[model samples]
Target: MENAQAVAPKSANSKQNSARRHRFWKQFFTYLYMVILAIIVMYPVLITFITAFKDANVQAFVLDFGGKWTLVNFKNLFTQTLYGSWYLNTMIISVSCMVIQVIVVTLAGYVYSRYRFAGKKFSLMFFIIIQMVPTMAALTAYYVLANMLNALDHYWFLTAIYIGGGIPQNTWLMKGYFDNVPYDLDESAKLDGAGNFKIFWSIVLPLVKPMIAVQALWAFMSPVQDYLMAKFLLTSESHYTVAVGLQTFINNAQNQQVVLFSAGAILVAFPIAALFFYLQRFFVSGLLAGGSKG
Candidate 1:
């Protein structure tokens, strides 16, 4: 009986020690994995930042920790290139696309959620089907159409293309989010003598602001990061977007401005990163809620 009592305490102590060691290892590995991933992701950004500030005499491709930092790369970026014009053009397109897309998608989503019309179900299914087709598949058609219309190098024409491509999926996402909102609110507003537009503007719109922010962010980013479409559409240096303009710096062996390219790349991230941080609170909620039903 005494032996059994003593053995019980020993077994419990051993089990407790083993569990503590297991938990310690689990936590240690989890932190190690996170640290490894952080380093991997941050390495390129760190290199770019360092390269952007290095002296003009230093080779841009060569990684050197010891160097004089200078602002000549940025100075050359604006003075030597058409970066100002490209930045303006890109900003115009992005803002125009964001506003127009938000209005169109919000209205379309509302209609699909609240109203029954001819071919409504078929239209919804059609959108889903068409969204499955990758944008690359239609590049040839876009190019031919642009050529035929003489819309090449037109910023508004490029904006229209972006807005058209975005509508189907964005509308679907918006509609799913709208579906989550109770119809009772709409009915109550109607009963209180509110018109359709009033209820939408005053009631439903506020509730779906998160999804709108998400949609706006998506719309804004489309032109900012696009390389292939912008390259194909805009040919004139005067009308180029930042993405296309930045590419010119290293497009050929003769015109390699690697440090300048790094500087431009760093500046390009500011607007996007600022907008993202501002809307980040809404981002996750909007995506999750919009996707919940659909």
Candidate 2:
């Protein structure tokens, strides 16, 4: 009986030790996986940052850490290239798209969520169908339409396309968010003689600021990151957005200003990174809450 009790304690200790080892390995592997992923993701960004600061004479593609660093790449990027104009053009398009998209999507969403209008279900379904069609499929149509309107190379025209292309999906997202807000607030506001616009602008809009921030961020980033649509539409170098303008640096063998491209790429990140950091608090919550309904 004494031997049995002593063996039981030893067995219990062994089992506890085994469980601890298992947990240790599990956590170790999980952390290892995260570290591996972080390295993979940060590698390009790190290399780009390194290359952007390296001497202009150094081979841009070679990953050399010991090379002398200079600010000439950035200096040439702004002075030699039309980077300033491209940056301004891109900012205009992005900001305009954000403003217009927010206003249109918010109104559409509020109407869809609060009103019982004719063909509402059909319209919503139509929006889903529109969303299913890839933007690439409509590129030819866009070009043709732009040609017909003589609006090729126009920033306003490109901005309109960005705004219109996003409307259907953004409307659905906004409507889903609007649905989560209580209707009692609208009723209570009505009792105080609040008009429809007053209820929407004052009461409901405040509730969905997170989603609006998400929409604005999305709208802002669309033109900033997009290469294909801008490349296809804008023929003039002067009219080009930063995405297209930056491509000109490396589009041909003779024009391959790799160092300048890297510098421009780094600078391009500033506005986006700033905006993201500003809106990040709302970004995850907005996406989650807005997507919850739809």
Candidate 3:
């Protein structure tokens, strides 16, 4: 009996050590993976940052920053280039898209959430199908359509395209979130003699504000980042957005300054970073709300 008790204690200690070793490996691997991913993602941004501070002679990949640093690139962007016009155009387009998309997505989501109608499943299926089709496939068709409508080089044209293309995904996302919200809220509002639009506008809209913030941020960012589509549709340099404006600095005949490109990139990235910092909470809350329950 004394031998058996001693063996049992030894066996327990062995198991405990094995468990600790397993946990240590797991934690170590997780941290290692995170560090690797962070390095991969941040390295490019770090390179861009260094390029922003170096002279025209410095190679972007080199770690050396021995050359003179000047704010000439930024100065040109603000004072000499068409960057101001691009910024203004982008602002108008982004804000318009935000308002229109939110209003439409919220309405569509609320209606899909609260009401039962004919062909509901079919409608959703169609949206999924449309989303599956690549936008690049319809490039020729869209270009033709824009030209026919005389929408070339117009901000409103881009805004419409942004809003239209954005709806399907936003609709699906918002619908899922609205599903998590109890139907009883809608019913209670209706019981107060609130109509569909009223309940949607006053009750449902307010509750799903987090998703709206996320959607608006996305809408604002997409057109700003879009290069190919904007380049094709917007021919004139003066009507360009920041993304297109950045291309001009690269095409300069005298000096192909990587530093200028970097400075422009920094300027572009700052607004997105600032916006995300401000709305980071809403972004997290909104995503969690969709992933889990209401």
Per-residue lDDT tens digits for candidate 2, residues 165-220, read: 88988888888888989999999999999998899889999998878888889988
Worst 10 residues of 3 by lDDT: 56-65
lDDT of 3 by residue, 26-129 (tens): 99999999999999998888888877877666644555556787777678767877877888888888889888998898788777777889999899789888
| TM-score, prediction 2 | 0.93
* Winner of 1 and 3 under lDDT: 1
Q: After superposition, how far is residue 234 of candidate 2 from its true place, in Å?
A: 0.6
What TM-score does each of the candidates earn?
A: 0.93, 0.93, 0.82
Worst 10 residues of 1 by lDDT: 55-64
Estimate every model's Cα lDDT from 0 to 1: 0.88, 0.88, 0.82
Where does model 3 exceed 4 Å of error?
Answer: 1-33, 57-61, 65-69, 251-255, 277-294
Off by over 4 Å in 1: 60-65, 253-255
Which residue runs does candidate 2 get wrong by more than 4 Å? 60-63
Q: Output the lDDT of residue 172, model 1.
A: 89
